[model samples]
Target: MIVAQRHRPSSSISDDFETQGEKSFLRFLTCGSVDDGKSTLIGRLLYDSSHIFDDQLAALERDSARHGTIDGDFDFALLLDGLEAEREQGITIDVAYRFFDTEKRKFIVADTPGHEEYTRNMATGASTADLAVLLVDARRGVLSQTRRHSIIASLLGIRHVILAVNKIDLVGYDERTFDEIASHYREFAKNLDFITAVPIPISARFGDNVIHRSTNMPWYQGPTVLEHLENVPVDDAYIDSPFRFPVQYVSRTDRDFRGLAGQVASGKIAVGEPVVVANSGKLSRVREIVSMDGPLEEAREGQAVTLVLDDQLDVSRGNILAAPDAPPQVGDQFQAHIIWFDHEPLIPGRSYILRTECDSVTASVTNLKHTIDIHNFSQIAANTLAMNEFGVCTFGLQSPIAFDPFRSNRVTGNFILIDRYTNATVGAGMIDFALRRARNIHWQALDVSKSSRADLMNQKPAVIWLTGLSGSGKSTIANTLERVLHASGRHTILLDGDNVRHGLNRDLGFTNADRVENIRRIAEVAKLMVDAGLIVIVSVISPFRSERQLARELMGSGEFVEVFVDTPLEECVRRDPKGLYKRALAGDIRNFTGVDSPYEAPETPELRLQTIEAQPEALAMRIQEYVERRT
Candidate 1:
């Protein structure tokens, strides 16, 4: 019989996996937009680890003969180019998953495509990765696609990043070159919120420092590719993240046993422990924990175990079981960061499926806050998340669903959006806020309306609406100014371009009418919030002067602080830190601002600040001065 290695959990089960010596496995994915050598890197890891089967090797040899060899040897890419179309084009066009095991642990690697058309597939591949091994070629270094993947990884709550600097041989494996790449990547990583990150140098083609130490690199002294995978501190496993087990299937056996069956997604559960059901809010005791082998004393995270409760509870698929001490909140609305993968933009009123673990519900895009420029990590005013764009968007669920913050429990908090007709997963979302607090605060006709409350609080509901072109430093200035006002005990809210686009404004598009509507909605919301006694600050690339004027008309006179975050188009495109300017120049993008659309400069404004120096501090102080004068 072929031996299948089974990982045994440590006895005397402490919450910490380190104490038990049972190193939890992390499934990491390698993703980029395109031409990032994702498949070749996976093949290199598989081949170097001596995991290639004899038959697979024979097939590779035949393919190499048929297609002609790259270096008169087997081309590893031949193994990963699965689809006939992909083989013909010699590019990864689908999500390709490969599995291997090292002495220390087992690993499941997914090599995802980096093409714009395969964005949905990329999301599917990366949805389950505990860590994302984002690859950047030494020749190309950091590209827009690289940044997109990094942002997605962060938004998806992939806590760890192993930035594999692939194709080091192309850059002569020079230490200076590697250091430069690492330095640039480090700067980018600052924009992300991962728990830990490590940059490593590797030549996937030659298998340099993959499974074994590299002979060519004398300057680099670190673990091999396999070693890093085997021993990069597997402390990030979500075993302690408050027990969250989504009931996948309920079983009623012939014997007197009815149990809830599903994978223990996070945390531990012991027999006789008080557990809370998420959907029904019913509490019960875990009489026994069952697996394929029958009864068990306890079950830990990531284990596919079933539990028989003492009381016969009405639990079904999508229902979550949690510890009573830290029960998950159930809500019909959740604030999430979504990445739009559909060809059609996400319509705010349209309903789609939001799938988290075993739970699936119809969810509507309640708000599209803002869209993020993945390159420079800046926000832009966007009403809808177009194809392959990342944004912060909120979803209104069909029913109350139990979930925790993605930061606390990824399995419980993360969800995927699906097209109803094709059942195709079009987007991935990470929960930011539960929205239950908003429910409590949104009681109609109870004590007071939100606007009246704000009025009583002595703050007019107004958005210090700042409008400008790309690279106008709207966020930088707004953030600094908000901090100043907040320090002065003025209730302030800074709605930045990128952070909001990721959520609230995600449903709006870049078209002229869409842009107008986008600003209109934000202005209305800002007015309500101001009426609720908050000094709301908003920064957006609102190109249409008429739209800005209309938003101003919505607010009371002097309440609307129309600030013009002015930076010349030439300088804006020059700073093109996000490389959007390069994409626009390449003719890959259409209807791009400053290229296809006319940007009307504000004729008259309360404040006009130049952002040519990339310093928003001076502009921020100017705005602070204006706010001080007004208040």
Candidate 2:
């Protein structure tokens, strides 16, 4: 008979010799705040389970003596956190993945970073994990970082959560403290959609309730962490939820053969089953499912194989193949929860490349509804989302795409926003659902034409936007220009900012987020007037370039003219006709564009007027003359 080691690894982690053939695999993650002992817990698991070799143990002891965090005892963290920087800082900086096996199962545990700034890295680890082991310091109880990580794990669709209350020894192994923390976490989790959350108190340093049950905790009668890992059910329900295959590659071996190659994102595929092209609604039956060995009769979710269709249908990367009868919802608009990751704040109305699987299209955030407060989980109205911020917003795609609600099908609903110029992934979004109106409302073909409307008025239908500082004479010049147009028998309307605010936009404030929405609403109104074949002159201090460009896109090509009324800051301050600048300079006004907030100048404008150098009447004449030449 073989002698069991002094450290009896749980039955789940029985020795390699006593193990049976073909163990199943479990992929999990360990996450929490820095110094919460995530890496140490993994190292303890590896050491106590006998996964560490004799040589590795000796090396760990030697390193522990020189720079161990806990006196001269063996520092298990040194084993998992392999980076030199991690050793020096005594914190896990990057995600460290380790593979180990026991009698019942194999395991892949990701030890992710815990700092708030490295949230994106944590998100990456959560994406592939079937279970998330959330570590919390027993002495500290619940924390904001812990809540944020839990929210992320839930958002990524990980239904199983293991709340590992680490370092119980430091808290005197008190059962009351453990229960209190667990209760707090449970109350917070009520808002989250995760299915199950199990709390277990453990001393990762002493191997208590990890691979072995602890003698100190006589009151507790739960399975060890190792035992829980062995029993936790891996959800394979996605395989039966719905069939969704994003075409990633086109395998054309020769003229005789062509295959649509991609991993089965969800559900199963079998020969003779009908599949629909999500983008084009083209239907075709599956002819063959081929693997490396040969043709297979069927393939399930997570399998990589080549699919041969019965008919010669047009299908390429970025196209989604789905069940013919239960098609994904198709639309050009969505309400989504997005996490911003780029250094630059997400600019509303700025065009980005929205990529889902292989499909990439021009897209933009049409509206920023509100942002989530991680500390208390409250919704705060926002104009833009900064790095690591989560916000609810509306998205507009250049073209319609097929998708399911993210809660129902992650493969078909999750997308990333890539910068058009740099191609950097700036944001990750999960679709709540397609906008109701986007699916229900269809554009009605109008009988009256834009050309006919303009002809009836006998003039050009244009939108001349006046943009500059507060006291830059934009309104004065616009008034003069409208008078000149009226004298010349042209139809015109002057939408002065102050006049509109008294009625249309009285509810809006001067916050950056509010400012973006202010411009968005005005742009829509301008588009409507331009369609009516009237010369619409808009005078406002539109500060941001992205919002200005959005207004341009709303109008026809060459119909929107941006007039930059350039005035020196000194000149504007001296001529603070409304005393607004005086209050702004005195710190009474907040989010005042030039005084406090940011102002992105137009890189190139249709017309430029230096108000400080010339009279308003002269500038108005110049603008009128330019319009006449263009029309």
Candidate 3:
């Protein structure tokens, strides 16, 4: 065994120490593969730092006897895995945050899960963290999850990392073992852009090299985990960056007082500083900086203050205030990295609600560039992103918004994608940069408007969309409806699903991605036809409800009519007019609606045509009457 080094005096490190209230704050997270002892390491830190209370310790001892996994010893993991499901399963399911303080620093540590299914939970914890504690089991060194967490940490802008090789006692505290794991990890992490990747051998269960140096590994000479954490530099670069204030709310006390209330996202603002609205380019000057305690001379990064402008501009919630000389990029198109969280795969061309710090707008992923392969860190071609998958995509917004690149400012660069129908958060994204085309393209004014064109044609513009399963009578009814409307001297056009495939959508296939593109193309065409003052009829087997909703949003309110052809699957299969169903069932065709593929019926449609209840001519006449009344 190697001899232990002589004890050094505490004065050698006195310059790095600070008093309690004056200590700097650090936010960090612990993450790794399942059963890698993330929760245990955090629990040890709290216990050794004298942050635990007697009552809490008593409760912990009692709980440890029942649910502990350490052969009746104190289970440090019990302190953080609080949920009953987590305790019973001996795993972390949600992100658990705990706050503690040392003499030199204050800390808010997030204990994240290690399971593959809960990777999204890990990302949530990493978002606000400045550093990451990546724990790895000594026996299972450098697993795939280790690479995945490192990639996520890098993307989230964390520059510092601690590679805690836990369970060192199980490997006999061997120096060779620790060196091999540390060297291998450093080789893999060199490309991740981490400024510091310090490897420390620790046994969270035994508390070795955690808060105190380990006697078992005399060959290792490094600062304990707590020592390194207390001395690491905290990133405060936002203070030097350009000013950014996202207007959260407009505070109005009386007719003469209108103050914009928000936290300064970056830089500083003073009473006389000139500011501009980022999206609108309206100029203004800060008249007064109002805080809760009354007027203040200035406010810097992270301070929440209200600013009274010298001029009355049209600024409101969702407008960003910035220094006139360094305004953020304003555009409607961008390239971003997205981590999908929902079970449903992300479909391109489907509209979602994109929510930023203070703005929400309709947005869609126009193209998926590639998905990262966690095992090899390689980019693979993909059309969609599934749950727990990360991809680089191009996003198109309905309206322009101001933003900075995520590397420049995390607060102004991050956004979440919400499902338009369910309001559930489906994906999290980071803006890279605004696309050049979005800034170059401009909408030119036209003398002829939709209303003017409609008046000239003597009718209201509309798009009637018919959706149903394959082999249904949608095309037949559409043909009959157009004939009835045309005979009445109404300008109309019919766009059938099969006819368009031969010309407009000739490059498409039967995959889900191709189907989405097919519906998108048809919707755009129908909208153009409606703008030209024609009653456009679209007949297609639009299987997905999301794509149908996308089509509806492209038109004006109440101008898009959804007609669901409610035909029984059995009836449609028997009628198989084009023999498509026969081929699908015999394995000659795939992705056939109502067979291998799913057809989501509309929950609420404008018109429900029961084909079995009436003939095609009669149903078409009913549709014509409804259109006449609606128009």
Candidate 4:
């Protein structure tokens, strides 16, 4: 759950209310285990601050009556328990977002669930938080769950911690109870790399020093929780930090004008300042700061604004804008801390679509270093990360990318792994360090033309990519074609979906995305082999047409042949060559393609085989004949 750190501190507050009513806001989240009273604490803050409306209060009163409470006393927990299950179980389940304003600033509080099951949701909530409020029960003190929460918060880049020792009333409001809990929290927090921490004792139910002064706790002398939140001196929000503006959207209001639109994640930006894009590392200058209303002289960090550049650049979504003074490195490899959220574990060597602020690239996990034990913050050797597990790993991107460390800038450093087939986000990664030095193998480009390579290999460097349901004889026909070509003195290579995996694609699996990357790597290797003057035969159950199109693009027209082994799904399931179809039908597998996934059949193919009735040699001769005509 370690996330990107760093924020731009506000240098000066604007007092011009009439011309520009720009108000700064701080976002924070509260998270912990169940029975931690996070909802109660939030409700107390809102109620004591008088932020609730009259009608809302009346509804709350009615709800309290339904719950069998007399006198309609404020059920502080009612403010955040919006879900039916939450009210019934009296436990928070989802990340409930609430907004309230104070005289000093605007606040957005994300009340996230405390259950270990919902750790991913909690990480999502705290990903955007500038600070975190961690609650500890005086009786339980700092338990294992407490340690887990603190570790996650710290790893998520929420540097500031305000530990609230709730239910002090049960502890006799004793100073000893308060001190003991505080001491334990301090010791646990010391192991984490936190910026600042403050522990305070209060009874959330009795409203002791939450917002107003508590006469019951006369022994404690310090500012109330609200006071500390309001007046705590935050460093320059982003002025001193490196500039990072992730281009979220491109705006072109008129045919004559164009601009890049996104929020400034960190640092300040001014007109004519030189900027570099992380994708291409191309430098440019800021021509104007385009706001919603009009142009601005300057745009500070955290402000969502459009930027007009002096030069036409290849800037797009998933790209970052940085100051020229210290540009970020553009590379394809890096080490990162990943919080895996999907039910399917991460597969090493399988390429996924890695997306950050404005840049997206096909990347693969090169290695999994180790996972951190949440309760202890100790490293444990793990092959794959399951749901809510935090691990350090190295990744290999397809293209070079420039990025700052998550500790330096949160916006440009955070990334999500998307399944190319399912489009589901599988993992959240924070760039720990970009490993620029990776081993590279250089292949000598022959002076022979591509067509010459095809001739030298005796067959054209073309990809006969076979795809169909399992047990479709895709492998049988492809193997037959390879032998016939060899007898004809035509050099060819057959990349069977399962066979090449032993060496070329050994690190991938059968998930939707992994399958796509499986085919992608095969296609890439096929292209290279095609360049080396060998006709490539690839047999895989590439169910998606989009992936086939990608393969086609990689090899170019007339090179990539989509050969449909048109076998019906029902027939293949009946065949059950690998027993996968039987398992899928038996409900042992959930995301099995051709059953759970919709396999898009090719509308057009270079060749089509209805069945394996034709002899393998006959099929091979037919493919060779087709190749001869094309060449």
lDDT of 2 by residue, 1-631 (tens): 1122334334434455456466777889999988888989999898787777756666777778766787747788988878888788888778889888777888889999888877887887887788899999999988888988998888887888889999999989999999999999999988888777999999998989998999999988988899999888876757877798989999999998999999998899899999999889999999999999899999998899999999989999988899988888888999999888888788676678898876888888988899998877899987789988889999988889888888888778888888765678788888998885546666899999888899999988999999999999999999999999999999999999888888788898887656766787888899888899999999989888767877898899889999999987789999998999899989999888789987777778999999877988899999999889878
lDDT of 3 by residue, 1-631 (tens): 1111222233533333344556789999999999999999998898777666656677678888888887657687999999999999989999999988877888999999998888889989999998999999999899988998998898888999999999999999989989999999998998887999999999998889999999999998988899999988996769999999999999999988999999999999999999999999999999999998999999999999999999999999999999999999998999999988898889888889999999999998999999998766689999889988889999999999999999999999999999887788898999999997846567899999999998988888899899998777999999999999999988999999999999999999988888988999999999999989899999999998888998998899888999999999999999999999999999899988889988999999999999886899999998898888976
Candidate 2 lDDT (Cα, whole model)?
A: 0.86
lDDT of 1 by residue, 1-631 (tens): 1111222233312333333355356687888746667777787777766667666767767777676236566677777878888877777888888866655776788888888788777777777887788888888887788888888788776778888888899888888888888899889889798877788888877888777778889998977767777876666467767888899999888678788999988889999989999778889999989888877898998789888899988899889999888888889987888888888677674557788888888777878888888878788877678888888877787678888888777788788888764577788888988775457655455566656776666654456988887776777778888888777777878776666667887986677656656776777778777766788898888776655665676677677888998888888788887888778878877667787777878888888888765467778888877876775
Q: On a 0 to 100 scale, what is the lDDT of residue 485 in model 4?
A: 77
Query: Per-residue alpha-carbon lDDT of model 4 for 413-454, expressed as tens digits?
Result: 788899765788888889998885744755567678788866
Model 1, runs deviating above 4 Å: 1-24, 437-631
Which ten residues in a row are the worst by lDDT in model 4? 1-10
What number of clashing residue pairs does each candidate have, in the order they appear?
Answer: 32, 1, 0, 18
User: What would the TM-score be for candidate 1 when compared with the true structure?
Assistant: 0.66
- Number of the top candidate by lDDT? 3
What are the runs in model 3 whose C-alpha is more than 4 Å off? 1-19, 438-440
Which candidate tops TM-score? 3
* Two-way lDDT contest, 1 vs 2, winner: 2
- Candidates ranked by TM-score, best first? 3, 2, 4, 1
